[model samples]
Target: MAESTLGGGAQAASTSLKNPRTAAAVRLGLAWLIVGALVALAFSLHETPNRGAAASFSLLIGVALGVTFQRGRFCFFCIFRDFIENRDSSGLFAVLSALAVGGIGYAIVFGAFMPNPSGRGLPANAHIGPVSWVLVAGGLAFGVGMALSGACISGHLYRLGEGYTRAPLALFGSLVGFGVGFLTWHTLYVEAISVAPLAWLPKTLGYGGSLALHLALLSLIAALLLRHLPELPAQAGGKLTWRRIYQAVFVTRWNPLVTGALVGLIGTFAYLRVSPLGVTSQLSSLTRTALNNAGWLGDRLVGLDGFAGCAARVVDTITNNGILIGGLVAGSLAMALFTNRFQLSRLTVRGALTALLGGALMGWGAMVSLGCTVGTLLSGISAFALSGWLFGAAVFAGVWLGIKLRLHA
Candidate 1:
């Protein structure tokens, strides 16, 4: 009997060693150790006097972003598309929760930034663009691009880390589109978008009042969204314990509401410290620099540096934005591996074509709108920018149109 029991134990040990999940967990652990070591090295040995802190902080935030996005599956395109196609309101509710939490965070941050709170001047670096035809056009294009490409800019970055082959082509298309947008920027800025108003709710209503109104609106929206969603049954479980917590966080998908709240908090912290939550400025910089080196882009298009939003600026080394992006990719990749969700899929010819074209449209749209979903919609609305609202509505409309036309199909 003892010999038989020993044999069974040995077999079980061997089986555990060969488990794919165990292998994935090992890989994930190694990746995180490497990440931690690198971050520590940067913090300890960075050459810059004052910039090290910001860069390190940005990378940390990026990692948080990547992890949250991967676990929550928080792709804006997927969220809306799921609801439209299958009546899944989970993502929408998550979005509302994020926006509500983000609004509150922004309000507090804004109050701190401008101690007076009732001052006439807007907070620095807010993404409040002029409301005009250009904004609508940009939003529509962005939505269509997202639908066709299967992801947004942020989505592409994190997905790329997961070995999605199509993401590279989409990102490359974005670069080309940005170049095109720059070529026509002068005409657009002068003729249509330059003179539009930069509207902020806080300026007109004050911080407290704006907060109250936004909270109320968000509550109503959440309530309506709940009406559309069927209730999920409560799971039968015993007392909450450490193993359960670990399982919830690492072994299973996170609740969207929880994920959204964390994302909002990260965004708020990021903006307060480094800049607004933009991922494409680095790509824009690369494109612009390449154009300048080749002398294709004129000097007139170099005016974005003076702007307050996520405008591209030339840099010889990695900027904070680059660091944040890198962190996001690496962090998400680690998490995906840990969860055994890291996958690499080949693209079909049609899919490849769609990715390229969709990427181009997204790039152009981002340039026109001065931000993508993260920059314009998420960060902008958090800051109470009217342009954010306009752009978001337009994006929804475009997505609906694309779905109706079977763009993704």
Candidate 2:
């Protein structure tokens, strides 16, 4: 009887392995195991003596950001494209919500750090950049790049984990572009950026006034965009179950407001603990390091190190930004796998060339402006910098022009 039972169990196990559903279940289980291992690695890194907690924390934050970006479809270019082509403003609300929430959170933190906003001193590491024609030009170029590449810098990073075939080329092009920016930095810095004003709202308006104005502007924008928001179709009511809850949370795209609020909270905490949320520092650093090592770039980039936005410097070790980016990609990959969304895309010559060109434009823009959309626009506005507003406007205009010209096509 024992021998018969052992044989029967073996047979059942073999049959299960052959079943398609069981195979899929096995794959998903493996994916989850990989994710769990990554989480464990993060904890292990945190406990390491030399690595410290910051690296681990940055990794975790990056993972959270990755999951959020993927689940919410929080690509800036995608959001703008939807608004421009489909007349859908629902995604735009996410941006407004994030800015509003982040602004409030920043105000609280700023109050704690520097109670007197009227003083000349500014918050440390906040994304307050100079306002100038260079900034506007950067924004325009970045926007056009987004349209051509079908994603912004951050978007490309996240999508890279989603099996985007063109992302690698785009990123390489960005490196080249950064090299080009390095080449022109001295001229641009001396000509325009040197004289640009670094305008902080809190310097003039105080924290309370600045926060109020920020909310008011966001409210006004939301009101204006309300007309463009399409009414979503209502879902039929169904009995709630654990499985249903799981499906809702894991399978479907998240609500925009919820996504935005979470992002805002993350940004706030990230600023409080690590630094302002920016993605370009490591990329720029890598480009700079490569160029410098090859003896192609100059020894000094004029006024580059003194800037307030994402600081790109020659680095010998992995910084927090590097850890964050790694975590982001890993988290995104895990999420993509879990959702069965990780499929390799077909690559074409046209697609590759466009991605490279677009990425180069974006990289140059980011380098010149001292940040990308995520850095100069989102984080900048959250910090109450006028440059953020100016950059945002220029980007919008650039996107509009690109769309009109069918550049994205």
Candidate 3:
């Protein structure tokens, strides 16, 4: 059996190498195209109406994130569901690794920003929001929406690049949900969030202390999860080589751990260079802009600008958020094509409807919570915000209930 397996593996490798010239040409062409497009985008941003290096930088960050996500399959909803339904903790471990890496990065960043971590002054513009009932409700709704739509907002973005038919409908529903969230934002803000507590771990523990405690906690969690790491059936001889390395890194799926670490690094770099990692910020802005233009959303709700969250503001020009989202799609598309993974999808009526409804839930949940899984749960935890943990638990619970209800079944 071992000999046969080795023979088969060698045959496959030889077949792949047979068309080396064509494969190399295709790969190089794709690489050049990606680089050219990025350069063009940067130049265009410089010459455009909202001319700034920031927008270009934001797009670059998005591209990195998109590539990482597509390559890693880093879907929060999927991670939770995989664990809940199949006891597959690999995806969950990826998520934890990302949080751990991001936490360390954020701690260093925060320390640099505010020398006195325990001082009354907080790190500027961290996503630490009030832990309110609305947050719980929003998280629950977001998770449910993820189950229905088959992905989260970030998931939909990258999947859309891969020709996922449901992504469009889900994203469209998210827009509508944002509109709904806008209509009720004033009440929620005034009634629930305004009076809620903002608990930042660094405020209590200080920067060094918070880093130590969180690292310890993360180490413990990682150790526990390590016991459950999937053990593949003992294979015959499968020797690693340079060709295999290329396939593993580019043509084949990356390890979740490596993907998570890359994601964490991207998130950290994004915060340091541009803004925190988020997808729905652009969606909310688009919704607000549309409503404002339609005269449905008046200046009365404009007070959201003062808040710390991914608040909406209507503008005619393209925003950094838009650039980020556009880059995500473009990056994913490029990667998919290069890897021969791009394909069009056609969805059934039921699937389409499910995606739309799920998207709407996600939008509403994001509006209430002021972020999605990426922005709220991941980034929040990285920033040492208690709301991140709370929102994350709520999202997990929602996913659990959704699976229990047989949403995926």
| RMSD per model, one decimal | 4.7, 5.5, 5.2
Candidate 1: residue pairs that collide? none
The digit string of per-residue lDDT tens for model 3 on 1-409 reads 1112212233344346335544445555775698689779877886776557788888888888888888888888788888888788889878888998999899888877888877785678788878989999999998888888888999999888788889999999999999999998989888987788888998888888888888898889888877677874453468988877777767767788889888889889888877888888888988999998899988667446765667677877668988889889878877776665666787899999989999999999998888898889988989998988899988888888888997755
Tell how far residue 400 is off in model 2, in angstroms. Answer: 1.9
In model 3, which runs have C-alpha deviations exceeding 4 angstroms? 1-35, 46-50, 232-242
User: Clashing pairs in model 3?
Assistant: none
What TM-score does each of the candidates earn?
Answer: 0.91, 0.93, 0.89
Model 1 segments more than 4 A misplaced: 1-22, 41-50, 117-120
Model 2, span 1-409: residue lDDT tens? 1112212233345457544455556657766886897789788989988787888899998998888888788888889999999999988898998999999999999998888988766888889998999999999998998888878888888898889988888888888888888888889999999999999999999999999999999999999999998887677687999877777667878888888888888889888888888888899999999899999986678798988787589987778898888888777877776776666799888999999999999899999989898888988999999999999998887887788888888
Candidate 2 matches the true fold with a TM-score of 0.93
Alpha-carbon local distance difference test for all models: 0.81, 0.85, 0.82
lDDT of 1: 0.81
Measured with C-alpha atoms, the lDDT of residue 367 in candidate 3 is 85
lDDT of 1 by residue, 92-182 (tens): 8777777888898998888888866567767877676777888899999989988888888898988887778888999999998788878
**Global lDDT for candidate 2?**
0.85
Residue pairs with clashing backbones, model 2 = none
